[model samples]
Target: MAWWMSSSRSEKGRFLFFVLPSLICWHIWKARNKAYYEGVQMRLGRICHDILIDMKGVVEVQFNQRLGVQTFLQLYEGTAHPPPCYSVQLVGWRVTEEGTLTLNTDGCSKGNPGVSGGGGILRDSLGLPLFVFSTYFGETSSLRAEVLALATRLRLCM
Candidate 1:
């Protein structure tokens, strides 16, 4: 059996096998470049040590995306990583002119072409609620429900 296979079992061993060759090739190239340019050569043990140290940087970057070094490898130990956070900004609705009303409309569907519904609200200049309505569209696309909401808004105004 190979030395790596003797150290670990199954997928971990396979993953290490895939990654080690690339690191080995990279370090070998670096050693070759130094020898060509500066007459310096790395011994076999030194080359292997350099490769291991370089791999540390790659692994650290991936773990940094999670939490810290202590908790990063916790997936194999059965501890779940926390979900990432995102920032969102929301603005309030604007008021209409004193003589006019603002109508806001929206629509929703269970699926692209499944059961759908539409809703609308009419507000005055001070943003106080004036009128509201919601209707079922049986089975239709969200776009159809949106169009129906707008049509209902226009009919209500007249």
Candidate 2:
């Protein structure tokens, strides 16, 4: 049987292992294209540096470690940002008759067509989270992910 067919590894681990080669190849291909098209030739040393920086950022975020929010912001701002937008935003708000207010905040991957994740939080009158969650969907087109997220959220709300 194929290694992937075995249940020895968790789904997440399997997914990571399965996609690792493709991800590496994708980066190499992209770097080559950048060198050829953008005239931004990067030596292997520079490429390794860039990859290290990227991996650090990913580890910080994944582990929910505050290595410093500013570091993340600087690394992700504008043109320096990676595949996903890192902006925080408000989604909805409501005022209750009991003199209370609520806010719904969400962060979405606008690049659904690309590999992305989506997350949201619903806060009560005190800004305390009633619920919060995030999901990652692998390689897809942005438009397709957008529509799918919308449809999924609508279903969740309903």
TM-score of each prediction: 0.44, 0.31
Quote the RMSD, in angstroms, for model 2. Answer: 18.7
Q: What are the per-model numbers of colliding residue pairs?
A: 0, 5
Candidate 2 residue-wise lDDT, 1-158, digit = tens: 23334455543335434554564576677789999999988577665555546544554565465444233234333212123437988855454555453433233454544676555565556566666656665677665555556655556555
lDDT of 1 by residue, 29-138 (tens): 98988989989976887787686665555554644533233322332222232234689999697766687878898887899889999889988889888999898988
Q: Which residue pairs in model 1 clash with each other?
A: none
List the global CA lDDT of all models.
0.69, 0.53
Where in model 2 is the C-alpha error above 4 Å? 1-112
Residue 28: error of model 1 in Å?
41
Q: What is the lDDT of residue 88 in candidate 1?
A: 94
Cα misplacement distance, residue 34 of candidate 2 (Å): 37
